[model samples]
Target: MSLGDEHGFGSESGDRRSDDSFGGSGQTRTRLPGGGDTDVYGGARRPVRNSRSLITVVGVVVLLIAAIAFANQGGGEEGPSGDGAKGTGSQPTAATGVKPVTGKNGQIPTGYAKDEQGAQSAAANYAVALGSDGMFKSATRRDIVQTVHDPAVTDGLLSDLDKAYSADFLANVGLTGDGSAPAGLTFVSRTVPVGTKTTSFAGDKATVEVWCTGLVGLAGPKSTKPVTETWFTITQNLKWVGNDWKIGSSSQKEGPTPVNGDNRASSADEIAGAVQGYGGFTYAR
Candidate 1:
């Protein structure tokens, strides 16, 4: 089975001082002929200086002051809140503040809550574990399957996966007979969650689709299967088991992918370094 086709679940501001002086020094003021009260230009004696104009200017100034006061009172446009948007009223893209489980079943995260959010979290975390480079190894692969799969189906799933990730399959992706990279190469398989949606959820069951982008292949000079990115969605049929969420079954499909941009691909060494340096997260929604 094609792994790619199957699992479908898936700025500084400067302050300026204002000058109060209306006119520059050494500028001469001309007086009108009447009583030095009007200018020589005689522009209708400044129109008797209407009190209504003064009132209107004062009204405008008052309105501006009120606006400034209201804005300051409302905290200046309600910028991004703790969850990262201004007045969005939407849930956070990722879980926060909720402490991760100290409990793990082998390498898989465990102790998830018995709720829809918990099920989504479990599926997302499991997707990462299942898509990691560790899945290529016999020991870790078995651990992962046992941890994530429903107990009733674990044995058969393991058997199927063993055959599916066979020596030839490993070799095609640049691993040796024992699933090790060539001496100079670093094998990479990493899945990063883009988002998750729960298509169906109940107390006892859940179906979660995890959208992800992954990097797989071998990273190094002279490697044939140079690491490349792919997008896929993994749909996991999960059941509430052992007080947590476990995978009953899963299938993957290609993608609701976007057009690739013009970004220059990173060098193999750079990719290797990055994979080694940056750690993956325990995803939740």
Candidate 2:
């Protein structure tokens, strides 16, 4: 294995500056409660007080009020709109309309709808199937290739992958000649999608990028390739085939990776136990 880059989720904030420029010696004039200036008829004169600190405080308050108003303008009951909206189209991040398919074509998800959501769902599920440990087994690999790939590309892809997952490759990853783990070892190869985005889309075709984290290696004592995590992005070019989305072509890139954390690595037995105990999910957008 080739380990890919890892990505992290985050939000950004901006700094605001306060305006300190005010006219007339930076002093504010306040009128006294009673009169002070008298005009001709001997009336009480209006007292005038110049306070710089008060003026500065008032200015700061005004700037704060303006900043608050500007910040709140895009929020509240109306929800996010315009450029701040969640999604590019009618579909929101949360699930909507038709549910994901429960049907499968020999372990690969099948029968997605003819819409964007369906395409995304198909891509996400296909990524998981393609990255699974089953791909190392001849029979299961063939099934996955046939199920997910386009009919025209399936044969070529199977031939290419058969070469790619050669005996040497299997040995390097601690698998046997037939892609089986050693007597006491458990092979772990699984992908979990963090998120999905549609890069390009049309009525019958779509390009979806699935940001994923994966685990791969042997989980047992004396295993050289111990189970470790990797991050990558899989871009699937899908076509609406036979009422469902099928992978016409697919590629993987390193990642929008983040820095590694300080978590302690689990032991071989622990890794094996976890892999056996936990189950994967049917991912959807």
Write out the backbone clash pairs for model 2: 6-257, 6-258, 35-45, 36-45, 36-46, 37-45, 37-46
By summed lDDT, the worst window of 10 consecutive residues in model 2 runs over 5-14
The global C-alpha lDDT for each of the candidates, from Candidate 1 onward, is: 0.48, 0.48
- How does residue 47 of candidate 1 score in lDDT? 22
Where's the lowest-lDDT run of ten residues in candidate 1? 15-24
For candidate 1, the lDDT comes to 0.48
lDDT of 1 by residue, 1-285 (tens): 012212211000001001000000111223344443333122222222211111111101111111111100000001111012212332223454465565666445688877767877887778676655555567766786778778887776666555545576555445666656777776665566778889998779999877766555556677655455545556678888888888876655445556554344567677666656555554434
> Which candidate ranks first by lDDT, i.e. highest?
2
Which regions in candidate 2 have their CA more than 4 angstroms from the true location? 1-97
Q: What lDDT would candidate 2 get against the real structure?
A: 0.48
